[model samples]
Target: MNSAVFYSSKTDMWATPQDFFDALDAEFHFTLDACAVKENAKCEAYYTPEQDGLDQPWTGRVWCNPPYGRNVGQWVKKAHDTASGGGFVVMLLPARTDTRWFHDYIYGKTEVRFIKGRLKFGSCQNAAPFPSMVVIFGGEHKNE
Candidate 1:
């Protein structure tokens, strides 16, 4: 367990499982990156908070991978709005189950996949000592 913690923290990026990515690929049918979302996937749009700014344009099929921190509410809210606006929002983050974001943003609105075990981050020390989840909402062609 300690080894897991040590690895995750160093890697600020929470590593997602292959199954999670596969599930997303199955639906979107496009090659996904930690950053951009290309239109070539037959996908219309892709949005990542890591980009310019939150206020930037959000059009077509959108994908958001926001920074997860203590104040993750903003990210959660944005993802919810994106989904409500007829866009697909797939989130990968620590399963801070006790937080309000877990209840409001994760609990009922999307499909949640709890990873079976701890994972090693690319080169990061394990700041996250526990399992993570992949929360997927909306659909490829689902309308708001």
Candidate 2:
């Protein structure tokens, strides 16, 4: 497995500002400006280097919009590990069907909330229509 830092940019770690984070900013009690590019952006929290912050075990509701970079598989795996260890992990990930992460970690473990369209990312807010999925894991497992 690759290091968590590989998933983020060296210059700017944050990628997309999550929608869920924006909806309930007060509840999280954190600021989005310093971490992410946009302010009051309706999104979940962006992924940081595990060395920097993601290492700790997070309890309760958790949000993660992992960086879409070289070693994204590692981050996705980490999210799955977080979910498995009794932590709520909500992730906004690109629908990369061919990747190993999609097959092993995501495919059969959880129910995916498929987005109707592509999400607008940071900076240019590019309209990426490559299909995305919101994988909710270890939150409320009433069905199972």
Candidate 3:
């Protein structure tokens, strides 16, 4: 297999697995999908690529499955910053714990749950090449 394509896909975005998202939504009651397209959006309120979620202020409980690539660090930093400003953010990310973003934002800064095995994201017949993890910044949502 070509390692380049494996690490950096033609499309950085990966659709979040439904069953996984359903479980998290049940727990967090997410108010916004911080990064999503129209068809696969997990919430009624979402930010599309055109909307540039990074430029917007995240509010309430947020769900983010950001595009995976070099820019992922920006997303992780945004999640941490949003939480620091009092918003709860949950992210579905590759379990690339050695990456700079993991050390910079996730290490000792958030709650992480590593998945047992690879995930079959979207309609892909095969499981993802990489492992996955759920990272939560801040606590459970409050009705504030």
| Number of the top-ranking candidate, with lDDT as the measure | 3
lDDT of 1 at 4: 47
Give lDDT tens digits, candidate 3, residues 1-144. 232332234677888889999988888889899998887789999999899999988997899999987899999999999998888999999999999999999999899999998988887677888999999999655443
Best by TM-score: 3
Model 2 lDDT, residue 58, Cα: 54
**Candidate with better lDDT, 2 vs 3:** 3
Candidate 3, pairs of clashing residues:
none
In the order shown, what is each candidate's alpha-carbon RMSD? Answer: 6.7, 7.1, 4.6
lDDT of each: 0.55, 0.57, 0.87
> How does each model score on TM-score?
0.63, 0.64, 0.90
Stretches of candidate 3 off by over 4 Å are 1-9, 140-144
Error of 3 at 39 (Å): 1.0
lDDT of 2 by residue, 1-144 (tens): 333332233422334544544643444443222112234223344323433324555554555665566666776777788778886666677888788889989898887878777665544335664677877767564422
